[model samples]
Target: MASENDYINYEMQKRTEPLLGVVIHNDASELNANEWREVLINAPEERYVQGIAHYYIDRNGQWQAIDTENIAWHTANQIGNEQYLGYEVLESLSSTDEEFLLNEQETFRVIASDMIDYNLEPNRDTVKLHLEFSETECPHRSFEIHTNWKTTVDGIPDEWVINDLKDYFISQIKQYMLN
Candidate 1:
């Protein structure tokens, strides 16, 4: 295995796009922040990686990732990958509803903190889901929780349903941002 310094030096690339805001995703695994970090930092290629997101949240709490300025290969959309910092909530698919809620809520708080730090207001434009830019059912946990609905078609969330999730997330983030 490669040493920590052997990969993901946070110097491999720099963001040329104007920093937009935050893009949220799910880790899709049961691993916590540290475990996910190990997986990502050691991965030999971006295609095989889970994340190097700016933050990871689990029931244990939130880990605001160390590298803030450089680009991370989280969002598949090139613009989002460069302009928006990504946050991963531990697991949506594997975790029970109760467990997922705990992790999701914790993610909200950390995102709120990052928003405040970056002077971003909580809204649809500032807070985004991975699915917003792609066809995947990413952030599936939040999609189900906020909309109380599932995919109507192929695994892709309906356009309006994703909006609902974004609204719910923004509201939650606002609650934390104010406090």
Candidate 2:
């Protein structure tokens, strides 16, 4: 297994584009965070793209890894790779359990935090799925999971659904701060 220290020193190239927004992804691996880190350390250059997400949310809704400033190699087809921040919520074997819901909430919280930190808008245009840039089904499972949660949850206005799920999550963050 790669030590925590080994995963900290990635020599990412400086980004040419100004930070625009956030892109969410699912790692699609069965490995947990530590195992994923070890695989990333040992994987070939071609596999580095999988390791490109700036942040990774573990199964427990905890922030396992973060690299906010440096540009990661997450998005493919050269889309949004440099222009947006990226996060990967581990979904190798995720299910719609309480743990997954908590993890999803943490994912939203981190995205909200990044939105504040980067001065970006908190809407569909800014907070996006990897599929928006690529043809892949990345984060589709997670997205569907959250979409269902929205329909079932109370207090979230129906109008919020048209705006985008990020808006709902942002509202949740606001509510969390108030309480």
Candidate 3:
């Protein structure tokens, strides 16, 4: 019989390399962080293709479902599964709420801290959105709300990239470290 810890041990063994960056995703179900955790924990593990995300962020704040060293099942097409750490931001059922917004900002700060720890750049090289690999419009509201914060690339507006978002987080991290 497979031991209870077998899966965890297998996941750890499979992660032989360091993560390359971070991938941001949205949990479209409109559940808060804690509720989402309950759903994931209760659901069958095999339902996830890449495995569950390493972290989740919502009105209740950030929660780690899996260790960063383990590969998360957040990306589609198997893209960046082994190369990146993944985070899922909880989506509200209706209009976006202030609590969710605050949690989102906190999520960014966490990502920025991770970037500093991993020595990754605050740009496309280290930060990415789920849309970059899949056709679905995941993290939909997040993109919509942050459209004005986009950066220009090759003289064209690139609204979907996470560079500007990362930049903001990086600034926050700098300010935090200075204090």
What shift in Å separates residue 149 of candidate 1 from its native position after superposition?
Answer: 2.6
If both were scored by lDDT, which would come out higher, candidate 1 or candidate 3? Answer: 1
Report clash pairs, candidate 1: none
Task: Flag regions of model 1 displaced more than 4 Å.
Answer: 1-10, 46-51, 64-66, 152-154
> Candidate 2, after superposition: displacement of residue 12 in Å?
1.4
Best by TM-score: 1
User: Which of the two, 1 or 3, has more TM-score?
Assistant: 1
| Model 3: residue 165 alpha-carbon error in angstroms | 5.6
Q: Say which candidate scores most in lDDT.
A: 1
TM-score of each: 0.84, 0.73, 0.73
Q: For every model in order, what is the number of clashing pairs? A: 0, 1, 2
lDDT string for model 3 (1-179, tens) is 11011122223325566777888776776676666566665566465544567777765566676676677767774556777888777763453567556656667776777777777765666677776666656555565565543112222225534555546545554554344
Put the candidates in lDDT order, highest first: 1, 2, 3
Backbone clashes in model 1:
0
Give residue 12's lDDT in candidate 1 (0 to 100): 39
Which residues of candidate 2, in runs, are more than 4 Å off?
A: 1-9, 59-66, 148-166, 173-179
Sorted by TM-score, highest first, which candidate order results?
1, 3, 2
Let me know the TM-score candidate 2 reaches against the reference structure: 0.73
What candidate 3 gets wrong by more than 4 Å, as runs, is 1-13, 95-97, 148-179
